[model samples]
Target chain A: MSDTTPAVEAGRLDTEALEQVLAAPAARFRHDYLEVRGLRVEFDGFVAVDGVDLTVTQGDLRFLIGPNGAGKTTVVDALTGLVAAAGSAQFGGVDLLGRPSHRIARSGVGRTFQTASVFDELTVLQNLDIAAGARRGPLTLLRRRRSVPPEVEAALETVGLAHVRDLPAGVLAHGQKQWLEIGMLLVQDARLLLLDEPVAGMSQAEREETGLLLQRIGEQRTVVVVEHDMEFLRAFASSVTVLHQGKVLAEGTVAQVQADPRVVEVYLGTGAHGRGSRTAATSTEVE
Target chain B: MSAARPGSARTAVARPDWWRREGVRLWGGIALAVVLLVGVAPAVLSDFRLNLLAKFLCLAMVAVGIGLAWGRGGMLVLGQGVFFGLGGYLMAMHMKLSDAGPGGVPDFMLLYGDGVVPGWWEPLRSPVVTVLAILLLPAGLAAVLGLAVFRRRVRGAYFAILSQALAAAFAILLVGQQKVTGGTNGLNGFRSFFGYDLADPVNKRMLYYIAAGVLVVMVVVVRLLMRSRYGELLVAVRDQENRVRFLGYDPAVVKVVAYAVAAAFAAVGGALFAPVAGIISPADVGVVPSIALLVGVAIGGRATLLGPVLGSIAVSWAETSLSEQFPSFWTYFQGALFIGVVAFLPNGLASLGGALRRRRARGSAVPEVGPASDVRPAAGSAGGVPADPPAGAPDVTTDTVDTAGRHA
Candidate 1:
């Protein structure tokens, strides 16, 4: 895998470099930012997520990495209104604490389920079409579904599934299904996207394609990915948030977090030290 | 295994463009319907049979709405009988009052309603208000009910139970209000409709024609609605409700509107049914008929455009004929038929074409029957992973980082 780090800055990248970054997987895209303070999620008195704070900016491809119960997915779920949440979350100027999930989605937030929850029986094109026009209401019942907007067409191309648009989503390969779900987010004009394990079950080549697609999407939208693939993240993530026991343990660039004593202790003791190497190494060698 | 798919590809091109390749079936259906309803029924059948057919047509209207609500919207609306009964009773009351001429209580109302028209019966005295009530009452009830139930996120079988309970309650209330409602014997003996003499054979024929025409119009209207964007949204909600919610749709609103449309359709059917059958009773509006309506929809293929209507008419016709053939056991025959269809043709008769085409491929595959029986909610397991990693799988769960690409 390519080890080149992205030239991530606070503001917009120029168009020439932006286009280049959009083409390459490891390049950064630039400005929707998210700020969270004192976020807590409790289920039946068990604290699933507790007192978490994070700041993320545009094209800020941040990775949330932890063991199974680290509360990474719960944090995303709370922001998307899946699980009950308390405290404050501000994304693109909207307070996203207790609003309904649909409302949060309409407020420009998008999320994907870990199990890849798509309308499996529908054609890929129909899946995107429904999401593309998700805001339609009951009064529009008499009106025919209009033509696919250019955004959907662009998303089809971006996810590289334009040719298979007529195929049912049930038959899609695992990686393609993941991309199609992301394509759904893109079609909804979502500004903030929370992806749950995007690269899981993908082939090595498919992972590379997804990383490039994620980078390309980040140029236009802020993406927060919850993933366990550290070797994949090391090459692609400009920033990383390490979680342990329902709280953020460390937040920094990949090398910085890897060097932190607490992060090393947690990961090493958990026997995850082999997955996330400190320096550039063969991508598949550890696996 | 090597047979070509002839129509699926042409579904997009090289076909009459109106309904796409589906247009062929559409035009054929219209032709068949016209021949059967217009040309053949009046010419061949006696007036008694014709009236029975018209009554079946009215019931088909209810099936149309049920197909959309229960079949597509996934509401499991076992309370449609309540809406149907309400509309029928409203129309029957208006007719009974009108037939009493002026300043007189209806014959049955005099006998059982304590010789006084209830205050609520006064508004239905005008034909325009009666028509409007028939249209709005059920729709309004459904809207209120849908809003309350869906907002609470009650769905699947619980919604079914709630709706069935509503139907039972409605029937019970009608029975208990014997003074106002003619008791369980119900309302009947209408002598006229508006100013027209109901005793006149021509007027009865006209009413029959009206019911047939209304059924046709409703089918067209439902087809238009099904072709629209809302149809796609409805189906999406059915397949993956949470996914639709995350896509920025309130699943409750989508469900409520569909439920309301169903209620409206059932209302109209009931209004016509009272006139054609010359009666409206608690017997017609109870739990039994509600299940009967769904049985037709299930037999016909709930999702197909013409399935519900045709299935309803066929089932009603079979009831008449089979009962004549086996007077004591026809109900059992109907039950057996339903069981056979559910067991063998689960997607309904509409899918027979696809099933025939797939016979070769089917032999090697698991024989799955019935959409109702086949498709189920995704197992509670998320992609086969438990909500939490079980203690047994600690190697994968405790060390997700070390597992690398093996995250569940």
Candidate 2:
């Protein structure tokens, strides 16, 4: 390895290769809706998101991929203002680094947790209506005012949950709940959507559907998804940023990054990049 | 793949047709019952009995606030008694000042220490000032306290402890301020309200009606709140504060608003309670009494629309009647009742109706399979299902674990 290309040359090889990678149907490159600079997040003594610099443009479908404990979620948490960060995270023109989660949300950065955050006791429509910010006016002063907005129905329709709109979110299947969470994000109409492992436990068919859903959503807003499932990532991600030890290991098109030797050693290790894995390496090469 | 999954037996029930169902019919019947009772009770019951009911109504008013804050907002508001006491003390001070006439000191002030009323108590001498103070003081205190605690992100057991400490501190302060607060005895021995002689039977009945009217108004107001967007937000804040924050709303502000509204209602109840109960003692504003108020709401079904009111009234009635019959055992009996209710009926008595209906539906729909027998596995495996578990169930961790496990 030492007899090989220089550090900068090796880095540029992956970057150049990544640029030539083909875009997936679900994942399209966003031109820079969010710009994060020198981001640093520390937990007591441990650095979580260390000096990470990334940008997510409008309509960008970015993937934050790494192995477990790679601090990928920490970066997402910092972007959403859930965790305190010591660097600049600007969305549009707003600095979200020190702002509260609510302020960040108001500034058009919406997020979904690894687990569904829907109100279990509430009806599915109510969940969407609540997410859509319905019942938030002077009419809420009066008792018996409507809880659901007209947009709630539209959101449910988009998520293919209109038929079960009245059922409680708690009763929905695992995949349906994930869809409902996405519908909530959609209803919010956030400029930047942060999805944490959207297809973590879904069936193959469900994951495929979610990929299609993400593809549709990516047309309207920037979506940054943190996922470990390489198949789903390959099927959805246009631009993948491989994170390892709180630093960006590789950033470019999936194919270019997959061919990067550094990414293979750190991220696309034996488990993720087995020999003869067609979807893992070959698809990226074809792109 | 075509075979029905054995574990997928519990499907989410279709949304209830609230308008066309018996639920609406049952609600209608309850409304009718309330109307009939209100209409005929005044004429049929003795004045003494009516007065008691009025007092119960006032207590119910306080419970309404408790229901909204603690029950729905997930704020364990242990200092509602502070608001209640504030209202009662204000009203009592005013009535006392009036009875003293001109510049004369209230009788308690002369007997205890200084022959002059305190400057703080001076404003409350006027009926207008007293009523306003009664309404504003509790709400103001609650708002300040709520802002401080909620803004700091203090919730669950910490919030409960903070509120309870406030109540304890308030009661002790009042007790220690003998010169101004009338010490442990508290302000009492009122002769009249407005110009109406409180001693007169008709006036007493009128007070009862007023209290009843106020209780009804408070209930309606809370009902409206619970149904409104704010109500939904309040519940959402209770269920998932962080999620609510991520939805473009400040959870602290929302919680504080609900807490303050609840405090205001409790103040109104306390003000009326002073006149009807004929006393405003430190005992009424202390920690133990505050817990007692929560007991009623919890037993009644804290989250339900009418649970707090019904539960409060029922508890108060039982306390009065039981204490009168067996004063020695009443406290112990009440404790037992709370323990039993909390243990067996975790959702409160209000949920019994819903539970019974569910049972009946299950019984009719699945005659061959017993619902009771299936409950264990259904509960065990229903990780993704969104059933409203009983209030006391330790389901918070379960939900978190299931969610994490699904994704992991």
lDDT of candidate 2 at residue B350, scale 0 to 100: 84
**lDDT per residue as tens, model 1, A1-287:** 01122311112112333243244233322335788999999999999899999888886788888777999999999999988899899897889988988999998899998888888767788889888886655565458856766666767766767777777777777677887898898788778889999988877777776787677666666889998876678768878998888999999998888778898787534334554554433332221
Q: Count backbone overlaps in model 1.
A: 2
**Candidate 2 chain B: 10-residue stretch with minimal lDDT:** B4-13
RMSD after CA superposition, every candidate? 13.3, 12.3
The lDDT for every candidate, in the order shown, is 0.78, 0.76
Candidate 1 on B1-408: residue-level lDDT in tens? 013233332332344323234666566667777777877888898999999998999899999999888778878888889989988998998898898877678898777656988888888888899999999998999999899999788998999999999899999998889888888978888888887888898888888888887887788777877777788778889889999999998989889988998998899999989989999999999899988988888898888788899889999999998888889787788799889888998868766655653543333223224332221222213236444323323222212221221121
lDDT of 2 by residue, B357-407 (tens): 544444443522554444434444555444645321223333333233223
Provide the DockQ value for model 2.
0.40
CA lDDT for candidate 1? 0.78
Q: Which of the numbered candidates is closest to the native, going by highest lDDT?
A: 1
Docking class of 1: acceptable
The TM-scores, one per candidate, come to 0.85, 0.84
- State how far residue B57 of model 2 sits from its true place (Å): 1.7
